[model samples]
Target: MDAIDEHIVSLLRSNGRASFSAIGREVGLSTNAAAVRVRRLESSGVITGYQAILGTDAPDGVAGLEAFIDVRLEPGRDSEEFLVWASGTRDVLDAVHVTGPYDYLLRVRVRGTAALDGFLRLLKREAGAAQTQTRLALRPSAAGASARERF
Candidate 1:
């Protein structure tokens, strides 16, 4: 990808709903040209998908909690099974297989501590996790912030 393509990606990352015209204006391309470039990025798997960033409070006025769960699988456990289960889980926002002390890192969202506790119990019982460490996120950085700034 060229510099223009990179810039388009940055714009899209910050605002996935940005119009082609807006992207074109920012990147010095015509609207059609910007749309074509975005299509190319999508076809090449550079842009896999778009997602909405939810606030701490939902539209229904319920506050949500976020947590990161570090899980270590038992020896001889089927890692694929755990991965598949985590992927299909409703409260699991994201799961990554990592090269570290933990076998997987799970980002979870729930309504309350009771819900989190229930989810953790289910994960341990069903996923065969030998151990787990859960850390509640006190606050998340602004969604519009760049990755470097958030980190």
Candidate 2:
């Protein structure tokens, strides 16, 4: 990709809904030229797809819930294997091995209570979790609230 194409990709990464005319103006191309290049990028799979990112609110406009689960693996279950599985699980945001009664702690977000129940069932059935203790987060603390901003 040329410099203009790189710039276009950068712009689109920041705002996927940017118009061809806006991209053209920023990249010094005509609107038609920008459209053609963007189409080329799409066809070539450089721009695979676009998606709408949901905020803290759920798709239904209700606020989602966050919880932390303390997990104890089944007898002879491998910690590395559990870590890998937890990493791949969609709702699991963070998993850490800690020195405590539990083997691992998992931070998760779910749309509602039903989703949380389903996730716990899946964890026990597929992830080899023998026991779990869960606590819901009422709100983010000062540090928790600013954690994402640091990134």
Candidate 3:
């Protein structure tokens, strides 16, 4: 990618919905040229599907008291089984299968402690004798922690 392509991507990263014409003007190109370039980038996999940045837009069927549950499953248990179980649970924001001492790291959000407790129980049962580590964030982590940063 050249300077113009980089500039276009930078702008789009900030706002994926930025108009082609607007980006074109920023990079000194016509609308059609900008569209072509963007399509080329997408086709080449340099530009993946455009997506909106979701802040606090939690998924459906779940609510409240979100926390990071660092989990360590029994050594012999199948990790994929744990992940598949997680995939079926809507309360899980996401899960990371990591190489640390902890077998799995989960980003969970629930209506409250009771829900969290229930979720933990499910995790323990599904993971086959797992140890849980939970953390509740009292407040949003410094809202926009990366709001001010250089690219």
Candidate 4:
């Protein structure tokens, strides 16, 4: 992608609701030009559909315990089957297949340890999870530099 494309993506990443006119103001284009560029990006698969990031664990909008499950599978287990199960499972927020000792890494959220216990148990029964390791996210202190901010 070029500089203008990068700028558009960065703006949307921070706030998906930004309008064509708003984006144009930041990137030196008119609303019609901005709209055309965005449409082209979407057609070319650079800009996927916008989505809302809703609160899963918090009713008052404060994020709660974010955790990862390092999942090891039994010999000859079907990875696709496991992934399908993981994705549809209620408590699972995200699942990734990655290279390492573990076959999958599951991101999850729950109210507390008791809720996590129940979620893990279901995971074990479904996949016969050979060995599972876990890590809990404490908090994010830094917002970090963005793509636009980097340049």
Candidate 5:
């Protein structure tokens, strides 16, 4: 993408709801021009989709506790099984197959400690995770804010 396209992406990343006019104002393009560029970005798959970054108090907010669970699969167990389960499971925000001490890293969100405990229990029982190390996330920050501030 060109510089202007990159700028448009940056603005959208910070605020997906930004109007085309606002983007034009910031990037020195007319509203129509901005709209055309944005449409191109979308059609080209550069702009996949927009999403709201809900706060803790949102109705379906991620305001609860977040944890990164490093999972170790049982010997001879297939990692694909766990990956597929995680992909379809609610509350699992992300699951990444990593090369390290753990077989996979699961990013999970829950309402409280009790909920997290229950989720972990269910994970162990059903996911075929032989062992896991859970680390609680502290004061998660927004990626958009950081990028905006830097630029």
Candidate 6:
């Protein structure tokens, strides 16, 4: 994928339901061109499935818990292999390689404590995570808010 494809992916990540026409306008492409690119991305497995997010006030399922987990891989484990697993895992919203005690930091959302426990077990069993430290997110920063505005 090129720069235009990267931009298209970013637009879709922010709003998966955005129309091809809207994406085309943002990326300086024709509607059909945008559609073609999106189709290519889907076929290439870069664009996964999309889903609806129920609001907190909604009468159905409760808003999920968000947390960050610092992961240390097992001895002689492959970082690339772990990354592949992280990318495919549904609850792992973001994974970053960072300079720290841990090899990676993952941002995730799950139903509740039981679901969180299950995910942790899966991470250790399937992803080769040797150690992990977790922190619950009390709240997220406001969208489009700058550092100065955040405080």
Clashes of each: 0, 0, 1, 0, 1, 0
Q: What is the C-alpha lDDT profile of model 1 across 46-87, one tens digit per residue?
A: 999997654574334545788999999989999999989998
lDDT (0 to 1) per candidate: 0.89, 0.89, 0.79, 0.82, 0.88, 0.90
Error of 4 at 6 (Å): 60
- Local accuracy of candidate 6 as per-residue lDDT tens digits, 76-116: 99999999999999889899998878999999888877889
State TM-scores per candidate. 0.56, 0.55, 0.53, 0.52, 0.56, 0.58
Q: For model 2, give the 10-residue run with minimal summed lDDT.
A: 53-62
Off by over 4 Å in 1: 1-62, 147-151
Q: Per-residue CA lDDT of candidate 3, range 1-151, in tens?
A: 8998898889888878888898899889999999998888889999989853323445363446769988888878887888888888888878998787788888877877777888888887766636888998554455455756422
In candidate 4, stretches whose alpha carbon ends up further than 4 angstroms from where it belongs are 1-63, 141-151
Preferred candidate (TM-score higher): 2 or 5: 5
After superposition, candidate 6 runs with Cα above 4 Å error? 1-62
lDDT of 4 by residue, 1-151 (tens): 7899999999999999999999999999999999998899999999879976543334344444568999998888899999888878766878999899999999888767767887788778887688899998664323577857655
Relative to the unseen true structure, what is the C-alpha lDDT of residue 132 in candidate 3, on a scale of 0 to 100?
84
Q: Least lDDT summed over 10 consecutive residues: which range in candidate 6?
A: 53-62
lDDT (Cα, tens digit) per residue for candidate 2, span 26-141: 99999999999999999999999996654364334445778999999999999999999999987888999988899999998887888899999999999999999999977644
Give the Cα-based TM-score of candidate 1 against the true structure. 0.56
Q: Which ten residues in a row have the lowest lDDT in candidate 3?
A: 52-61
The ten-residue window of minimal lDDT in model 1 covers 53-62
Q: What's the true lDDT of residue 142 in model 1?
A: 66
Give the poorly placed runs of model 3, Cα more than 4 Å off.
1-62, 141-151
